[model samples]
Every structure is written in structure tokens, then in C-alpha cells.
Target chain A: MAFLEVASITKQFGNQLVLDQLDFSLEKKQILAVLGRSGCGKTTLLKILAGLVSPDRGSVRVEGQPIQERPLPERGVLYLYQEALLFPHLTVEENLGYGLKVRKQPKPQIALQTERMLYDLELSAHARQLPSQLSGGQRQRVALGRALLVQPRLLLLDEPFGALDPETRSNMQLFFKKIAQQYQITAIFVTHDLKEAVNMGQQWALMEKGQLTHYQQLKDFSKDPKTGLQQEIAFWKKIDHQL
Target chain B: MKSSNLLSIGLVGGFLLAILFLAVGSLATEWRFPALLPERYTFEHWEAWFQKKAWMYYLVLSLLLSAAVSITAVCLGLMTASGLSRDKRSFLWLRLSYLPYGLSPVLYAYSMQFFYHISGLAGTWLGVYLAQLILVYPFAVVLFFTYFDSSMHHLEDQAGSLGASRAVVFQSITLPILRRPVQTILIQLFLVSWFDYGITSVIGSGQLKTLTLIVYQYIGESNLIYSSLASCILMAPPMILWLLQPSRSTKQDIPV
Candidate 1:
């Protein structure tokens, strides 16, 4: 059984059917990148998996149980929006401790965990500062720290690097890839940049108009002699060049 | 920059003139504020205000209504803004609540009287509070919603994901973030409650005598000096706080 599975998930936003019987699954300690053109249901699918939205039909299961049945901030599901969504009123330590505070964890424990997160994510020096004080890259790093401090079982990132400049974004992506491996945390990331999806994800799922049309290993996509995959790779290579 | 400053000066100057005219009329009896220092000034009228116990009652009345209106208006504004921030179903209703706020308060009072009369709420303390809530909650909602819908919306969602329960999210994130706007609305509401006579006279039914109510009543008695002093006292707190507020949204890096 997979660690997470979104099976036949269907969703509609008013008149538009966003996700149509989409199915995908992932293993533990794997990074799954969801790639799609704009207006596809990549975000919708990520939100559904994160339990931020409910699917119209079908279910998202984690470790063989449906995630929908679980309560918020439970089942260790976290969604990192395209924007960092840092709490404007909280400092770095306070933001990291937000989840711990909500869960009623002990103060010493929260302090310990926040310290670990700050040092681990290279955010210790910026801990006293607010989100607005930090540079774009620094803020995103704090956002990651906040998310990681929650000790979430599954991390759902909705273009977490969406706002940074190309140089910053490229560096952060490599930094994040390293962190994701070191922590051995399962993650689903959505992005328009195919190079990011290709290089970062162990598994890549292509979404087209809400449907998960393709799911394959990155090795398979890169190594397949198929002309279709080759063209897709080439197209993203051009984009990567421009970026 | 200079033009805006001049406009502000002019606006203050115009108000000073009107007040000066009123004061001049009052000082023909006793009140005074001359170009520099008054050659002659008497507070026999001011002493008379303290000597009158009715003034004390009017102070209490004004204080009660201001407290009632400001607290309830702000609370309702916060809750409604929070509800509107998340729930889109009542967007039209939320938008419509603000419509009357743009209309003249006199017109609103003119329209509100019939309902108060029918409901037997006329001339009641409850009636004044309700009227102020109706008048001010919309302003509060507008200000609060605008703040919420901005980048603050993202913080709200992130707070939810961060293990804050819906209630926790409200108290921990929403309320704290809203301090600046809520404070702004609070001062504005205090002024509105202190000076509002349209609904006060219409709904007050000659019984719910607030400071403004008594001021106008003093004017009706041809005691303009007495009323001027009374109005000045009534306006003090809001006047003080308005000057005290941080002039702009205190800007620094958003501490998240």
C-alpha cells in the first residue's frame, strides 16, 4: 500500500468540473511533483490532498485510511501556499510555535523544536525578525521552517517558490530538494516549471484540465526513447535555459 | 505636499471660524476666545454648567451610549468581517449593509424612526445602541473586510494549517492582525456616538438625553453659551485620542 493515494478524485468549482476521476499514489519518503499548464487542476488536486478542499467524488487516503475523515492539523497534513502566507503579527519563533501552541504542547518542547527548526533551516539569525523584514528568499526559508516545525507527516507545497526571482528560486529549489531528502518526508509540489518538476520529484504526475493524465518515474521520463516524452523534456529544457 | 497641507489647514480653519462664530455668540453672554488672550472672560456660565446636576446626568448618558455603541459596534464589525472573510454567500448583504452608511445619518434617522416607533423602541437606551450599531457596524465591516481580504487572508489560511483551530485562528491570528483597523474604527465610532443627534433626537423621544441631546436642548432654551461649554466637554475624549493615534499604519517588516 502507498503512503498516500488520491484515487478517482472528482471536483467542480461552480459550473466547471475541475478534477475528473483523477488518480495518483505516492510512497513514503518520496517527492511527487505535479506539473501542468495554467488553469489545470494542479492546485485543486493539491488542496484536496491537503484536506483544504473536499473532492466531489472518490477519496484521498493516507496509509490506507481516508484523509478526509481526519480533522484539521491532524493526520500531519500541511499545505504551503504559492505565497509563504506568513502570519503578519508573529515573529519567527512564534510562527514556528503556532502549531505547537495550537496542539497545546509544552513550552519547553515548543522551544526545543523551534530552535531545532531555526538552526536546521538556516533561519536562526532571522528568528527575531518579522516576515516583512526578510528578503524574499529568507521569508520563504522561514515559511519552510514554520511548515517543518509542525512535524507534518505529509507536506503539500503549492508553488512554494512561486514568488522568488529566478536566481533565488533556482537556489531554493536545490536547497529544498536537499532538505526533503534529509528529512525523508513525503511531499507533493505543484508548479508550472517542468524543469523543477523533473529534477526535484522522484515521481512526476502531469495534470491536464484536472485530470492526472500521466504519472511516471523521473528516470522513465528522461530515459524513455518515446518521441512524446523527448519533446516534453526538450520544451522544458528551453524554459530552463531562459530562466 | 504643500497643497495637501494647505487643504488640511483650510479645513481646520473653516471649522475654527464656525466655532468662533458660535463662541462669539456665546460670549455676548459670557464665553470667549479672542485673537490672542481674552481681555474679559467669565465662566459664570462654565460654573453654572458644574452647578447644574443635569449636566452630570448628560455626561453619564453620553458615556453610557458611547461605551455601548463603540464596544458592540467593534465586536459586531470584527465578527461580521471575519464571517465575510470566509463565507462568500452573504457578500451582497455585507455590501448592502454599507449602503446606508454613505447616506446622510439624518436621512437614516428619518427612515429609522418609523421602525423604532412600531417596535416601541423609540426613546429607549436600547434604541440608541441599536441605531449606532446599525450606523457604525457597516463602517467597521468595510474597514475590517478590506484589511482581511488583503495579504492578511493568506496569513489566516496559514494559521489554520498551523494547527490553530477555527476559534484559535480567530483569536490568535484574526483579532491580533486587526488591531490597527479596529483601533481606527473605534475612534471614528466614538466620535459618531458622541455627536450623533439625528438618530438621537428622532429615536431618543425626548427621554434618552445624551450629551448631544442635551446640547441641542440647551440651544432650544436659548442658552447657547451653556451648550457650547457642554459640547466641548463631550467632545474631549475622542478629540484627544484622534491626535494620539499612530498617524499611519506603523510600517516595519511584517513580523510573521
Candidate 2:
């Protein structure tokens, strides 16, 4: 059985069918990158998996148990938005320590874990600084640390690197892969950038009009700029037109 | 820390000036230069009311009722705001709900009396409270909706991913972040409720009389000393809360 099972989940917003019994199953500690154009409900799917939204039909199961009656936090699902969602009132240390604080972990363990996360993410010195004081890369690192601090089984990333420039984006992407490796956490990252989808995960799923139309191993997909991803590129172009 | 901020502070001073001018004619009863200060500092008039045995209870009841109304209204407002924040359009409904504040308090109170009376709430603590709730709930909703809507979108999601139950998320994410706004709303609702004579006079007339209504009674009787002393006494609780407030971190936040 898959560690996380999303079986034919259906969601609708008014008369529009946002998701039509979308079925997806994934292994534990594996990375799945969801690639889709704007308004295709990639974010919405992640939200459903995170238990942030109640689906109109179908169900999600974790570890083979139905999650119908469960709340999002109990499912150990974390979502990272495209923009950093750090609390403006908190310092970087406190922002990263928030999940730890919520779990009511002892102060010392929080300190040790935060220190290690800061070091791993190269955010040690800026611990006392506020989020407004950090650069884009630093802010994203703090966000990652916050997600990892809880030791969540699933981390739902919603295009968290969207705000960074190319240089920072690539750097944060590599850093994300490293943390994902170190923690061996399951991550479902949503992005429209094809390069990000390919680079961040072993598997890639294509979403269109709130439906999952394609799924593949990243290595199986070709990356040649001239001919590669032509179908996806064209599919997104049409979707953009519709949007 | 902007020029607009300085302008707002200047406006608070201007409000105090307006209040002072409201009573300037009392000073005109005797000659006073510039008519800014009262003709004579006479405490015996309003102070005599304070000296009465029953007067303090009005102050006590007003404080208790307003505080309760502020807290209950805030919780209700928070629920509505958090629920409504999921959609962008729900804000229009929330904003439109504030039409009560735009109406004359006396008319609103009289109109609402039937609802309270039929429910067996009038002349009862809960009745008077619900009356104030109706009048002030919009303010609570407006204040907390602004505070919670923008920030809470991602908050509950994050909390849930951490093994927190729905109740846990509500407790952990919604409540902590709410401290600052709750403190602010508490003071504002208290001030609004404490000074509100229309609803008080209607719902709490004999069952309870707040310092505000009593002060108004003396002012109508042309009893300046009684009105002034009662007004001063009535203003004390909110004044103390405002003063004791900022030292607490939650009370000191800039609206941003």
C-alpha cells in the first residue's frame, strides 16, 4: 500500500469542477512535484491533502487509514506557500521554533533543533533577526526550517521559491533537496516552472483544469529545450489563454 | 512614526478639547478667561452622587457588562471572520453588517427592544448584554476581521500540519495571534459600551444603571457637580485599562 493514498478526490467550486476524482498514491519519504499552469487547482489539491479543504467527494488515506474524520494537524501535513508565511512579529529563531513551541517541546530541545536547522540551512547568525530583515533566500530557509522543525510526515510546498530571482531560486532548490534528503520527508511541491518540477523531484505529475492528466518519473522525461516538454508547454499555453 | 500618525495624536487631543468645550457653558455661569477652564473647581456637586451608596454599583455593572460584551462579541466576530476569510467576497457582507453603527443608537435600541423583550432578555443581565452586543458586535467584527483575515489564511494550515487537532489549531494559532487585537478590541468596546447611554437606559434602566446614565441624569437636572464627578468616576476603568495596557506586549502592537 502506498504510504499516502489520495483516491479519486473530487472537489468543486460552485458549478466548476476543480478536481474530478483525482487519484494519486506515493511512497513514504519520496518527493512528488506537481507541475501545472495557473488556475489548474494544483494549490487546491495540495490544500485538500493538507486537510485545509474538505472535498466534495472521495477520500484521502494515510498509512492505509481513511482520513475522513481527521483534522489537518493530526495528519501531520505541512504546507509551504509561494510566499513566505513567517509571522511578522516573530524573529527568525521564534518563527522556526513556532512548530516546536506548538508541540510544547522543552526549551532546550527547541534550541538544539533550531540551532541544527539554522546551521544546515546556513541561517545560524541571523537567528535573532526578524523576517523583514532577511534576504529572500534566508527567509525561505527559515520557512523550510519551520516545516522541518515539526518532523511532519508530509510537507506540501506551494511554489515557495516563486519570489526569488533565478540565482536564489536554484540555490534554495538545491538546499531544499538537501533538507528533504537529510530528514527523508515526503514532500508534494506545486509549481508551474517546468525546470523546478524536473529538478526537485524524482516523479512529476501534470495537472490541467484541476485534473491530473499525466504522471512520470523525472528521469524518463526529456529535458531538451528545443523538443522536450512540448506537449506540456503547449498544454499550459492553452490553459493560460483560458485563464 | 509617520506624519499621519502625528496627525492622529493631534486629533485625540482635539477630541479632549471638544469634550472640554461641551461643558464650557458651565464655566460661563461665572466669569472665566478664555472660557477654557471651569469657573470654579467644585467637586461637591458630582461628588455627592459618588458619595451615595448605590452609585458605585452602576460603575461596577457597567465595567462588568462592557467587559463581558467585548469578550463575547470578539469571539463571535472572530468565528465569523475566520469562516468568511476563505472567500474574498465575504468581506462585503462583513462590511455591510456595520450599518448598525451608522444608525442613531436611540432608534436602534428602541427598535431592538421588542426582540429582546420577546426573548425574555430585557431587564435582565443577558438582555442588556445582548443589546450592547448588537450595537458593538460590528465593531468587534470589523476590528478582528481585519486583524485575522489576512494573516490567518496560512496559519491554521501550518498548525494542522504539526499534529494539532482543529481545537489545537484554534488554540495555538488563532488565540495567540489574537492577543494583541483582543486587547485593543477590549479597550475600544469597553469605551464604546461604557459611554453608550441609549442601549443602557433602555435595557438596563432599573435592572441596572451604569455610571453613564446616572451622569446623564444629573446633567439633565443642570447638576454640573454631580455630572462631572460621575463622569470622572465613570471614565476611570477604561482610563486605567488604557494606561496599564501598553506595558503588556499584546496591547502595544502597531495596527500593521
Candidate 3:
């Protein structure tokens, strides 16, 4: 059975249908990148998976067990926002230790794990600094580290690097890809950037006007003229030819 | 003059005048009209006021009342504001929360007099506390409603999805992020309750004697020295709280 299965999800806001019978599934430790424009229900889909929002009609199963009406804590899903929403009052170390502490892990174990995460995220030097003291890239790293430390069964990213500068965004993308592989994490990354989706995801999906179109491979995604990758490639190719 | 410059000057002028009055009124042993300066200066009035057991009782009572009111209001406000912020359907009733704050406290007290009489809370300390709570909790709600932005809701949802229970989410995420704003609201509510006169007077019915009432009585009796001493006592805690406020540098880094 697939690690995660989402079937026939439908949602509406008043008279506006925001999600229309969307269906997808993922294998264990696989990453799916969802590409879409604004108001295309990509975020809504992620929220539904994270248990932050409910679908009007759908069944989400993890490990073949239905997750419908399950509480967030029981669902074991986490969502990362576009902006790094670190706890401003806590130091980086405290932020990293929050999940373990909440889980009632032993003090020494929590400290050890937090220390390892800090080193892994290259945030050891910023252990005592508040979120405001960290740079944008550093803050995002801390947020990612905090989420990863929780060891959720499924992680959902909503343009997690959308606010970073180009250099920082690229660096974070590479870092995410590396850590996700190292930890064998299952995630669904949502982005408006086509390159970002192609770079991070093994499979790709496009959402438009509350409908989703899934592609099994990069070639399949690029070949579909309706997905807009073909037009983007043609435009770049024309520019190269002129040069 | 630029408005900012005018505002600065006005604030400084007001502060200086307050200090001058407090100093003169608390120290002057004799100062007849037409004299720019006091004929004599002494700290006897302040010393005597501080020594009185009645003054201490009133001060402690005032502190306890303010603390109780602030704590209750903030707790209620946090719950109400969080619910209202998460659900747009509750917004229609949000304006109703402001009704208590918008109306005069004395008028509100009059309207609740029948309930107070029947409940036997009309002239007790509990009655005064409840009255002040009714007056200040609405402000607390408004403050928290405005203070908590949409990002906070996102953070809350994220925490919940991270396997944190509702209590854990509140303790680890909501409370930590809202520490500064909550502190600010508590202090504001404390000050409002500490300085309240109308509702306290009407509800207490001469039974509960808080510092404000004592000060008012002193002023009414034309006793400037005792009134000034009471005013100094009233201002001490808030002044200390203001001095202990987090620096601008520390405040700059709060996550949006």
C-alpha cells in the first residue's frame, strides 16, 4: 500500500469551489512537488493534509489507515509556511528543543537531539539568539530544523523559501533536498516556481482553477504543453538562439 | 513646528509639570497664596502617610484588586480573541465586546445594580472586583484581538500539526509568541483598574476602600499633602513597570 493516499478531495468556500475531486498518493520517503498559481488551491490541499483545514469530501489514509476526522496530533503531519514562523521569544536552541519537550522526552535526550539538530542545521553559533537576531536564511534554517526535529510522518511545505533572496533560496532548496534524503522524509512541496518544483520533486503535479494534473516523471511534466513548462522552455530557447 | 517635535515638547512639558506638583505638594509644610515657592519643605507628610496602617491596607487592597482584574481579564481575553481570530463567523459579535468599554462605567454599574443587589455582591470586594473586570476585560479583548495577527493562527496550526496537543500548542507556541503582547495588555488593564473611580465607587458603596478612593477623599477634604502622598504611592508600581519595559533593541527582532 502507498504510504499516503488522498482520494476524491473536494472543498468550497461559499459558492466558489476551491478543490475539485483531487486524488493523489505517495510512496514512503518520496517527495511530490505541487506547482500552481495563486488561488489554485495548492495551499488548501496542503492544509487539508496537515489537518489544518478539512476537505468537504475526501479520505486521507496513512499506512492504509484512514485519517479522516483525526486530530492533528494523531495525524502526525506538519506544514511549513512561506515565511519562517519561528517563535520570536525563544532562542534558536529552545525552539529546536520545543518538540521534544512537548513529547515529554527525557531532558538529556532532548538536549542531545537538539544539539545534533543545531549542528546539522549549521545553527550552533546562533543557539542563544532570538529569531529576530538571525538573518532571513538562518531563520528559515532554524524553522526547518525545528520542524524536522519533530520527526513527523509527513511534512508539507508551502513555498518555504518564497521569501528568501535568490542565492539563499537556492541554497535552502539544496539543503532541503539533502536533509530530506538523509532522513528519508516524506513531503509534498508546493511552489509557484517551476524550476523549484523540478529541482526538488521526483514527481510533479500542477494545480489550476481548483483542479490538479499529476505527472509521473520530469519528462512527462516537460512534454505536457498545457503544464506551461514547454512554453517556458521554448521562450528560453528563443532567447538563447538570439544571443 | 512639525507634529513630532510639537508632541515631544508637549510630553516633556507635561512630565516636568507633574514632577513639580508632586514634589511641592508632598513636601510643602506651609505655602500661602501669592508665593511662588513654599515657605517650608519637609518629608513629614510622606513619612506619616507611609507609616499609617490604613494607607498600607488601601495600597495592598488596590494592588490585589488590580492584579486579580488584570489576570482574569487577560485569561478571558486570550481565549475569546483566539476563537474570534480563528473563525470569521464570530466577527459579527466582536463589536459587542467593545460595548462595555464604550459605555461609561458608572452607567454600566447602574444597569447592573439590580443583578448585584440580588446576588448580594453589591457592596463587597468581590462586587468591586467584578465591576472593574467587566469594565476592563473588553479592553483586554480589543487589545488582544488587534495584537494577534493572522500569522499567529498559522503558527498555531503548524504547532498542532507537529503532534502538539491543544495544551502543548498553547504552552509552547501561543503563549511564548504572545508573551510581550500579553504583558503589555496585563499592565494596561492593571493601570485602568488601579485608577478606576466611577465603577469602584458605585459598586463598593463605601465598603471597599481602594487607593483611588482614599486619594479622592483626601482631595475632597482639601488635604493636598496626603493626596499627593497617595498619588506617589499610586504611581510607584507603574513607574517601575515602565522602567522595566523591554528595550527597543530587544523588541526589534520579534517575528511577524
TM per candidate comes to: 0.89, 0.81, 0.91
lDDT of 3: 0.85
Task: DockQ for every model, please.
Answer: 0.56, 0.36, 0.62
From the highest DockQ down, the ranking of the candidates is 3, 1, 2
**Native A-B contacts reproduced, model 2:** 0.47
Q: Give every collision pair in model 2.
A: A73-B160, A77-B161, B45-B225, B45-B226, B46-B225, B46-B226
Q: What fraction of the correct interface contacts does each predicted structure contain?
A: 0.67, 0.47, 0.72
Off by over 4 Å in 2: A104-107, A213-216, A223-243, B1-51, B84-96, B99-103, B111-126, B236-256
Clashes counted in candidate 1 amount to: 3
Report, for all candidates in order, the number of backbone clashes.
3, 6, 0
Expressed as tens digits, the lDDT of each residue in B27-118 for candidate 1 is 54543445453445575777776888988887888888887898888888888887787775667867787798677887888788999989
- The digit string of per-residue lDDT tens for model 1 on A144-182 reads 878887778889988888888999999899889878877
The TM-score of predicted model 3 comes to 0.91
User: What is the C-alpha lDDT profile of model 3 across B50-127, one tens digit per residue?
Assistant: 677788888889999999999999999998888887776666657888777666888888888889889999889899
Indicate the worst ten consecutive residues by lDDT in candidate 2 chain B: B247-256
What's the candidate order when arranged by decreasing lDDT? 3, 1, 2
User: What is the per-residue lDDT of model 2 for residues A1-243, given as tens digits with 9 covering 90 to 100?
Assistant: 998888888999999999988998888988888888888999889888877788998888888998768756567778888777776667889888888887789999999998988898888899999787888888888888898889877788999899899999999999899888899988898898888988897777878876784455554454533224767777889999999
- lDDT pick, better of 2 and 3: 3
